[model samples]
Target: MPLPTQEKAAGMTTRGGSTSKPEKRQSGCGGEVKDRRTVEDRLDELLSSMLTRDYLDRQIKQLKMDIHAENKEITERLEGRIYELETDNEDLRKTVGSLEKEIESLHAARDKTEIKLNDLEQHGRKDSLRIIGLEDKSENESVEECVEKIVRFVTDKLEVSLNKNDINIAHRLGNFTRTKPRNIIVKFTSRRKKHDIIRARKKLRGSGQVIFEDLTRNNQQILKDAFRLKCVKNTYSIDGKLFAVLTNGKKRRLFMDTPLSEEYLMNDGNFRRL
Candidate 1:
């Protein structure tokens, strides 16, 4: 007998095959289904990876924006603070300038007032003289009587005549002390009488008696310093100007407002140089 051919539904036959055709078709279909599922899974993974990348990109962009905003805010705050500080500094400068101007005005006013005060003081003391070496009287004797007796004695010693009415006022300068007698201050009615008394002052030079012009405290200190200088002699002040009689007999004018220094005292020509 001849080999039999097996026929299937689509008119296909297999000769001496162990598997049926239907089974082969089933296997091919199963393989196609598996390949399709693998392709779908790979496509899903690709889509997920792309979505994740997009999300990461968005997050990174947002973070960058936040950083930029914070930086901008900080910069604006710093700038504002700087501006405020600059404004404050400008106002402070203006205030300082105003204060400086005010201080200068006050200084000028003070200087003018001081000059006026000094002038008044000088005028008030113009007709005054100071007499030294007069002994303090006992409590029983009146001060006025003591002054009159001393004045009479001074006039007699100088061989000059002075009227009792010439002295407007006479008194000791301070309280009496046991150690030393206070100097007598005399105010004359007429400037002529004062000049006469001063002219006659040389008569009492070696007699331990002294007559001095009633100068201001400042001028008195200047006179004392001038007398203390080694090279100076016959130191005197006239009209607030200090004068010194040099050892060489030359008269030199000194700066009354400034203190006498060793440099000024040592060199006789220093005043001239000034």
Candidate 2:
């Protein structure tokens, strides 16, 4: 049966060898109707099959196109997200680096401060420094003493207008030697005055400060204390020479010692305040 069916299909070929069939008409009308019905059924089946196949192919192509479009959108979104994450990571790294640098600077400053503090503490005092009491010839330090000490120190001396506020009588030197100041510097708001300049001359009479003195006529030359007195209105030099004196009724005369040049003046600045 299969061979016969195959032969029938081969016989449908036309003279050009393409698949085609031709119909023959019978003399009877009924026989012709039956043959025509069979041909119509075959044609219907071929047309239905072609239509179904076309519809299925078009649906598959549409499904493939939709999948491709969705995949493209997803890939673009992921790429954008990755770019944002990379930028954020870079910013965090920079911030961390800056913080580390600041911490290092603070540590360096702290180390320098510690070294300076140690140096200062090392030079504060010596082991030989000690505290001791002073008597008649006190040590070189100011200390409290009784009124009897002040009275004994000023024996036979006519104390002038003694401003208690200005009087600073104190004992110094342990017992080896005692030094008393003669000339006193009196400071006022408007002017300055030197007191006991003559007194210092009296005190220096037996000391090394005076060169000569005549006790009978009270004619004498006195050494003014440069450490405690200023020769603003007086005419005296460090050489113990009094050039000009304030006469009772005459104007005081001043003579300028030869002026020293700026370079020759010994500008080591150690004796600048002196």
Candidate 3:
């Protein structure tokens, strides 16, 4: 009996039961279909947004790796360039120092050469001056010394003191006047026509390392004096007493008065008593 009743409720084909159940069921189906369509649409929108976000994230990670690699390469290149520059700078510094040393050495050599040249030039000038002095002088002595020696020799040998200035001035004259303007005189004597009269006159006129005039007188007294002093090993005696006698041939005769001797005179290499 209960089974029959349950079946009758499930089927509900009676007019009253069937009518109430169908109305209620129709209302719930309509509302459920609308809600199910809305939920499906929202799930589809969420899935589309998630796929786009994942793609963008992958691209961002790849870009970051590329940027990191590029920065590393740039840093390495700059470091290498800096290293090369430093090496070049060191080499340049060494070259500059070597060049400076070479320049300094060159300057030192130049200075040494200049000093040596100056010393040689100084010595050469001194030698040239000495040679010139020899050329310009007759006696080895200085001018004043020669003058004093000759003057004293003549005075002592010939018993006469000559005026120093007068002789000095006269000796410098190149030619003579009828009256000599200067008062100095040279007197020479030779009994020998064998005497090179021209030669003797030449020597006598200008043996003083100076120019002179030939204002000469050839005479008896001048000839006698030189003969007494010139002849070696001769008895130049007057009145049985020897006067000034010549002993050596090398000795030079100095006489203020030529013909100062009254002894024999040399003629044709023979002594003839006059």
Candidate 4:
């Protein structure tokens, strides 16, 4: 079964003695080495790409954390400032409330003091009298001269017994003016003597002479305001208590704080009707 040399070169014989073509064979191992180099190069490229992508992902995650931290810090700072402002505003409101209460207390205290002072002033003037339409010829008149004039006038014109000793002090109220004669203020040693003179004031009513009780400035203004009303026929004060005689023959007791209005003055219930 040995084949000829030409046929052996063209084909091969198997165990069954059948003719078959031979598999092709490479001349060297260069092709296999080249294919292995190509596979290593592709793996190197894929690993480098994966590493770069991982680095970028880490950088992005860190940047997001940084931004979140910065925003949290800013929000905390703003919230703290708002809380401080709210606390300050509440404190200011409390301070204003305290100030308003203090002001009201001060006003009440002042009103009480004014009332006490007015009462004291009226008490001091209980024995004093004001003589209007009295003649004052000289500005250099002495207090004793004024006292003598008051005594003579009370004795002669008023028909009342008055002595120089009964009058404690007498003086003109203001500077001498050529336009009119100033009134004289006389203080008596006793209220009895002042009352006696006042009781006799009506005798000189037609003689162009008048006498009035010494009143506080506030009471005086109240009397003046009462006189200005047409409904008030006559106004007078006895012991610093003011009285208004209305046109209907009724008398109304008035006070320093009474309203000087027609409606208030004309109220019938307030008057002692004739």
Clashing pairs in 4: none
Residue ranges of candidate 2 with Cα displaced over 4 Å = 1-53, 125-274
TM-score of each: 0.65, 0.27, 0.29, 0.64
Total backbone clashes of candidate 3, pairs 3 or more residues apart or in separate chains? 7
Query: What lDDT would candidate 2 get against the real structure?
Result: 0.39
Cα lDDT of model 2 by residue, 54-158, tens digit: 788998899999999999999999999999998998998998899999989988888677645533432231111111221244343333333243333333232
Residue 58 shift from truth in candidate 1, angstroms: 5.5
The number of the candidate with the highest TM-score is: 1
Highest-lDDT candidate: 4
Q: Is candidate 1 or candidate 4 better by TM-score?
A: 1
The C-alpha local distance difference test score for the whole of candidate 4 amounts to: 0.86
lDDT values, one for every candidate: 0.74, 0.39, 0.42, 0.86
lDDT of 1: 0.74
Error of 2 at 115 (Å): 2.3
Clashing pairs in 1: none
lDDT of 3 by residue, 1-274 (tens): 3354564568654554553333333345465233555669989988787779677799788899999999999999999999999999999999999999999999989877865664454333221100000122332334465346445644543334443552322122233343332222232222121122222323333333321223112222233445545464432221111233355433223222223432333332333232
Error of 2 at 210 (Å): 56
User: Model 1, residue 180: what's the lDDT?
Assistant: 74
